[model samples]
Target chain A: QQPVQSPQAVILREGEDAVINCSSSKALYSVHWYRQKHGEAPVFLMILLKGGEQKGHDKISASFNEKKQQSSLYLTASQLSYSGTYFCGTEESTSYGKLTFGQGTILTVHP
Target chain B: DAGITQSPRHKVTETGTPVTLRCHQTENHRYMYWYRQDPGHGLRLIHYSYGVKDTDKGEVSDGYSVSRSKTEDFLLTLESATSSQTSVYFCAISDSEGLYSNQPQHFGDGTRLSIL
Candidate 1:
């Protein structure tokens, strides 16, 4: 099943903070965050494995809550470069590589 | 980048015609996936393969088929194209069963296919 993402879209100013959440109906083994610019392939951001691990890249970080079957992507001190659509993909308990992606969250950061 | 390439970056074909999009990777990764992106759907998985000749359907598998005959190539075919299938298709690969299950998938530039 495709995960559910909160705040379909958000607008922020530089140096602001924003959070995007993804939840799944089934147990998840891992959660991945990616950013896609207009008309481009999604770029990897970070991956949070099961067992409550937290992962981050640059100013972007994510946490996975096995109990809730959810994950959240945190953008700290957001920059204009962070403007893009963010998607979260999840791996179900039984599948290894198969991923179901959320509808996506559009984050717009302005000056 | 993972050295992934998708053929015919842009294509426009009539309805009811058979169209095949090719995804080639030099990384020899064991996992390959095909996904379609639409306005509100984000990216929906059409199919994926764990190994050569081992493929499986995904949530949006209807009207779409996939093949992985070799380690370097995966193909997604539309038996009969339709206007509903017009969207951007992406091919991705991962080296470690995808970042511990939800591993980061390295995506190709994507194929823009339009059914008229």
Candidate 2:
């Protein structure tokens, strides 16, 4: 099943903070995040593993709650460069490398 | 940035014609995936290959078939194109697995296919 992302879209000013949430129906082994610009492929942001491990971009941080089967991406001191569509992909315990991505959250940071 | 390249960056074909999209990667990642991006639907996985000749279907595998004859190349074929299949297709590769599940995926530039 695909994960659900809240706040379909958000607008923020430079230096502001925003949080995007993602939830899944099934138990997740890990949650992956990616950012996609208007005309480019989705770029890797971070990956939150079930057992409390994180990897990827330094500017953004995320958390995965294994108990709730949910994850959240936190953007602190947001910059104009953060403007893009953020996606959260969930991996179930049974689905090895496969991921089911959320609908996506559009974050637009203004100058 | 993973040395991944998707061929025919843009394509426009009519219905009923067979179309094939190719993804070539130089990273030698064990896992390769094919996803379709549509407005409001985000990216839906169609198929993924764990290794050469090791392929599996994803949630939205209908109307799509895939083949991985070698390590570097994965092919997605639309036996008979349909209007609904027209969307931006992305190819992603990841080295994540049992011991390295934290590895993030890297994507190709993507192919914008338009089936008219």
Q: Considering every candidate listed, which one attains the maximal TM-score?
A: 2
Put down candidate 2 lDDT per residue, A20-94, tens digits, no spaces.
Answer: 999999988899999999999999999998889888887788888999999999999999999999999998988
Give the worst 10-residue stretch by lDDT in candidate 1 chain B.
B95-104
Docking class of 1: medium
Docking class of 2: medium
Q: For candidate 2, lDDT tens digit of each residue in B10-115? A: 9999999999999999998999999999999999999999889999999889999999999999999999999999999999998876633468889999999999
Report the lDDT tens digits of candidate 1 across residue range B6-79: 99899999999999999999998888899999998889989998889989889899999999889999999999
Recovered fraction of real interface contacts per model: 0.81, 0.77
Chain B TM-score for all candidates, comma-separated: 0.95, 0.96
Scored by lDDT, model 2 comes in at 0.93
Task: Give i-RMS (Å) per prediction.
Answer: 2.1, 1.7
Instruction: Report residue A58 deviation for candidate 2 (angstroms).
Output: 2.0
- Residue B3 in candidate 1, Cα distance off native in Å: 0.3
In Å, what is the interface RMSD of model 2? 1.7
